[model samples]
Each structure stands twice: as C-alpha cells, then as structure tokens.
Target: MARYKAPTTRLRRLALQLRQLREETGLSHQQVANETGLVASTLFRLETAKTKPQLRTLRTLCDLYRTSPERREELEALLRAASEETWLQPTAEYLPGPYAAYIGFEREASALHNFEPSFVPGLLQTEAYARAVIAGSAPKASPEEVDGRVAARLKRQELLTQQEPLTLDAVIDEAVLHRLVGGKAAMRTQVEYLREASRRPNIRLQVIPYETGAHPGMHGSFAILRFEEAQDVVYIESSTNDLFLESQEDIGRYSLMFTDLQELALGPEATDALLAKVLEED
Candidate 1:
C-alpha cells in the first residue's frame, strides 16, 4: 500500500548522507534553503531521494555543509555511481518510474525471489508471451511503447546469463499454468520454456497449488531483491501505483512471506511434473 517515487540504492545512500550532513549543521530545511537560495521542497526531495541530484546542487550543498575533504570525496563517488547510465536508460520514457526502478534493482541484485499469482514472471517470460502481456495490460499503449516494454522485459532476462548470474527463485500460483496469455500454441511454448529454464542451476521454479487454499500470497504478487553491497528491498507492483519497501520491518515481513510461499508451493520435482501436465493439457 505504501507508494513513492523510487530511487536506486546509491542514490538512497547519497540522500541519507546529505540528510546527515544537514543534521550535523543544525540547520532546518527552511534554514538550509535560505542559505542556499533553493526552495525548501527541493531540498526535502533531495534528502528523501525523490529526485536526482544534479552536480551543481550537490556542490552547493557540499559547500553549505563545509564538508570535509574525505567525506566530500565519498559523496562525489556515490554521485557518479548513482548517475551512471544503465541499460534501461534508453527505454525509461516507456516505463513507469517505479517499474524502471524495479528493473534497476534487478540488474544490481545478487539474488531475487518473486511470487506471481497471475502470469509468468517477467524474467522467465518468452518474447511472444511478454508482448501479449504488455498489450493486454495496457490497452492504451502505442505499438512502439509495447515494443519498447517487451524489449526491456527480455533485456531483464540477461541477468540470469550475465557473469555471476542472478540467482532467481520464483514461486508462481498454480492458476497461472492454466491461464492462457498469448494463445494455445504460445502458452505451450511458454510452459515448455519454463520447464527448460528450471533445469538451470541458477533458476528455481515452483508452483502454489489451489489445494493450499488461501495463503499469504493472496494479498498480491511481490518480489524480494537482495544485494551483496546494498540492503535488501521488497518490490510490490499494482495497477495504479508501485511500492519500494526498504525498511527493515518491511523487508523482514516480505522475506518471511516469500519463504512461506516457497513452502506452500511445490518442490522442484513436483513443479516439473506439474509443468509437464500443464503442457499436456495445452
């Protein structure tokens, strides 16, 4: 239910440092704005990581805070890292801000656990299936927008193949196996692709059967992304807005929920069998 304009992890760290610096100076946001001749709301957004900090703004704050040489060097390092262009940058205009942030998280994460109660997880989806999903979900989207989205989705899959590949443990609802997205033939191919993808050492796929009845995932689909250097984050997508939960409490709760979903879902062998059965039905 919590929603906000999400920022990448480095930006988050930079925001915290900037806020701490301001706190050390014992200056209120209003006071800082008066000193720097910038709007208070703009300062507030910088501290909250809601907006990207430009070089001039960063330099202005550093000067106002009288930052030490050592600390200033660290802040500059983070600024460069945070502003570095990513693969998603080219297609960002086609994506929702939060969704773009989600992919950014995916690209940097060491591991990810996802729960889907509806269609296939984006990373595991085929090109045709992804096209169908984009078209169906955003009926108002232009042909170019759909293509860009689909391209982005496929690009996300590269994480599984990149050096030190991302470890993905995805648990999907049983209902998804029967829900046709593209068409019968397309669905069959998609399922077949899943069965093959599950064989990879880095990918672990499971299914939560209907027999389990109502469970934690009944709330909705979500993913837990883990990073080696940064903190773990929970991403929850919705029709209207998306969420990026970084608090320890939210991370702990979502991590526990993903564990519960994994238990409720079938194991590796059983999931393989189920996918095979679904393919037969198709």
Candidate 2:
C-alpha cells in the first residue's frame, strides 16, 4: 500500500508552533481535549505533525490558546504551505518512517555537520558508492527496489551541486576509504570522486585515521543539521527507529562531538593527500 505522507517543512513548523502554544498555556493534553471536545490522542498527533491538521481544529485550538492575529496567520500559512509541493517533494512515499522526514529537513538545511563511521555520507556518495552500500546492506531487496533507492539517493546529491549548495562539513572514518564495497576498482573510483568533491567550495571533508582509537563517534554515526530560520536538529540513524533530536541539549552534545571529531581528524589538505595514497595503494 502506498503511504500518503506529504512534504513536511510547513507541517514541521506548524508542529513546533502548536507545541509551543500549548506549552505556553500550561494546559495538559487532557485539559485541552476536555475544553475543546477534541480527543487527547488527536491533539498529540496534531502537535507531532503526524496528521494534517483540519482547519476547523486549528481554529478551535487557536481560540483556546488565545493566539494573536499575527501569530495565528503565521500558523495558518504553514498549514497552507504543507499541502503544496516542497523542495525535493519528499516523493518516495515508501521511504522508511522518519527517513523521508530527514530528507525533507536536509533539503531545507543551510549547513550539515556529519560524522560517518561506516560509509560515506549520503550527500557525498557517488552513484556507484551509493549502489554498493545499498545493495550490500539489503541483499534481499529486489533489483528494481535497489535501483529506485539508488536513484533517490543520487537525487539528494544534487543538493551539493545546486547554485546555493548546502554547506557540508563531514568527518569520515579512515576505514571507510579502505572498504572495497563494490570491489577494489569501485572503491578506488569512489575515493577519487571524494578527492574531487572535497575541493568544491561548499564541501569540507576530513578523515580520522585509525590511530584515533575509541573516539566519541565510534559508537554510531549521527548528523547535526542547522537551518537558517529554524532550530538545529540532530539525526541519529537506527536499525529500527531513526531519531530526530530537536532539544537544545541534544543539539549541543552532538555539536560538541562533531567539533571534537573535526579537531582530531585530518585537515582538508591532509585528507586530500590521504585519499591520494589510498588510490595509489588500491
């Protein structure tokens, strides 16, 4: 069955604003439900952006919160915007839960701080590198499914080449370069692409050598996405439930971790040299 999730930029903003309004009133979900005759669960879904908010419902809640006209109009606009196509469109409805949301956020982000201990970051991955990573990890997926996924991923790489490209600061583990995902030849190609991509003004790539033992990033990979207009978000990929951490505290921890990794990792010049060496050895 096809999922019906729309692009979530405007939806996400509405979610945050709705939660903020509710918090300002200091009313429990149950209290608001009772006053408005709305179900508590429905309110939860609305605040979390799980459901497309009905206009009547939004109006009722706005009344309950005693929102000023200006603030209410802002929210109404977001609701209207949610129904429109967003940048990238979040078109792959079959993308796993929260995965589409992450892509949607990435599309609108101004800058990204990424730490990848396993493979290259999606934004930096070449088509072949992405194909190897996808196919190797999900051997059971049909060739058609793999092809579709590979295409979707490559589409994301466009963000890096766009006129106003997303600024990417990525710290990749040294071992990632050595992994011959598609074969020795394919890995070499991927490394060469990385060397070229690193020189782009929008991308800042670094490599952490094997000598950096048991670092903060050893446990897992995560990304901190910063927006020009909104608060920062920390994304942690998981086998089961991928997480989007929006709290200031969570953002702080991940930001500091990336800073530490950046300091420990080689500079761009060193990274270029290291990739050159890997290509020679391969």
Candidate 3:
C-alpha cells in the first residue's frame, strides 16, 4: 500500500521514451542537448526520469531526432497522460517521486512478494505503528503530514479485503520482530496484527530467522511485484533512494533471489509458532 502521486508516472514514461529514442539514434546526452538546444542536465533529467519535460521541449526533441509521425503521436499521448491527475492526488504533496511511482506500480499489481529486513511492511502496519515509524524516520514532518500519510497507508490496506484482493507474500526477517520500532505497546500491537494477518487466505507470511546465515537478501530488502497486463518489476528501497527494475534480466535475478529466500524461511506453521513465542516473551 504505497502512497500515490499522479504526475510522476507520465513524466517517467516520457523520460524513458526519450532515452530509448536517443539510444536508438546512438546520440550522447550532450549531443542530443547540442542538437535540440536543450540543456545537457535537462536531457539527462528527462532520460533518467528525474523531471517532466514541457510539451514544447518534447516536440523539439522528437523533431531533432526525426521521430516518425506515429512515434511522435505516441509520445504526445504519454505527455497528455502525464498532465492528468490521479485519484490519490490529495496525498501527493508529501510523497517523493520514486515513492509515487511505487504507488502506481502497487495499484496495478495483481500479486506482490515483499521481503523486509527492517520495519514491518506498510500494507500490514496498524495506524499507530505506521505513525510512529513515519515520525521517527521523518522527524521534520508536521503532525498533520504524518496523519495524512497514515491515512493513506490505512486506505491502501483496503486492497487486501477487496473483492479482487492482491495476493501478498511477505517474508520478514526475524530481527524485525524484536526491533521495538514504536515502543513496547505499539510493537505488541504490530506483532499481534502480523499474527492476525497471517490468517488470511490470500496472504502468506514467512519469517527468515537470524540463523539462516548469509542468505541472498542479506544485502538489502526488495519486493518483486507481478502484474497481470504488465511485466514484473523488482522494487528496492533504501534510506534515501529507491530503485525500480523492469528489465527482464534484473527482474529474473531478483525473482530467483526471492524464491531462494522463501526456501530458507520458516514454513507457515513454524512461523506461526515462532511468532507466538515472541508474543509470549513480549
């Protein structure tokens, strides 16, 4: 249940198309900038999807590259899409660009496999737990902003109970259970929620113990989302940056890694028992 922002999606697609056309033409970023009268930094931004290009700028790039009429029309369509507002526009203010893209991906995904080594995944977090986690991570955020984000996250959980629920397979590191993210009471409730969520038919919760020494996901946490109409994407998030990998090779590698991690984690019955033991200790 990631937060949504509308504008970034269109911008991202346009950027990707621009980069692809440049690559096909074998033009360097500086070369494209020089020929199109656009700044090198701007070209770079468009290619890497850091910013949205104006309509005129997009037309200029297409003209410089001698793109076909059909292709130009397609790019314009992308631009138009970028200009449209999304349903989650109210929550767009606080969300960063990459996160906005993640929300878009999450909304379209048919199934999601998430592995979290640190905090609990957002889709499963209770309101109080989510508030504490966000506040701790973003200390400068106003209370109202935190509440908005919490509300957004809670709204995302509706996908779980929808008529067409997204299949969620979550692999959590055992350490997350003991981290005490939101104080004793909040953590207690969170752990209890995890136990309750595990009861759902569409959700599969597994725990990778500390003893699973040197597993493939030891480097970082990632999620591989599978969509019905689109290709699978692997999302990797860090403290300050996030990456979305759509290339088949990269997605395949992460999928393999997820499978391996799933193999090493405790089975459902054993995982439930372990969770119960932790709750008792708490």
- CA lDDT scores, all candidates in order: 0.90, 0.86, 0.84
| lDDT per residue as tens, model 3, 75-151 | 99988877777656788676766676677778767899999888788899988889998999889999877887787
Summing lDDT over every window of 10 consecutive residues in candidate 3, give the lowest-scoring window.
1-10
What digit string (tens of lDDT, one per residue) describes model 1 on residues 168-222? 9999999988888999989999999999999999999999998999989988999
Give the range where candidate 1 is weakest over 10 consecutive residues by summed lDDT: 1-10
lDDT of 2 at 88: 39
Which runs of model 3 end up more than 4 angstroms from their true locations? 1-4, 7-84
Question: TM-scores, in order shown?
Answer: 0.87, 0.89, 0.74
Kindly indicate the candidate among 2 and 3 with the higher lDDT: 2
lDDT of 1: 0.90
Candidate 1 at 165: error in angstroms?
1.7
Task: Please write out the lDDT profile of model 2 over residues 245-278, one tens digit for every residue.
Answer: 9899999999999999999999999999999999
Worst 10 residues of 2 by lDDT: 86-95
Which residue ranges in model 1 land beyond 4 Å of their true spot?
Answer: 1-7, 23-40, 63-68
When sorted by TM-score, best at the front, the candidate numbers are 2, 1, 3
Give the true-structure RMSD of model 3: 4.6
RMSD of 2: 2.4
- How would you order the candidates by lDDT, starting with the best? 1, 2, 3
In candidate 2, stretches whose alpha carbon ends up further than 4 angstroms from where it belongs are 4-7, 23-28, 85-94
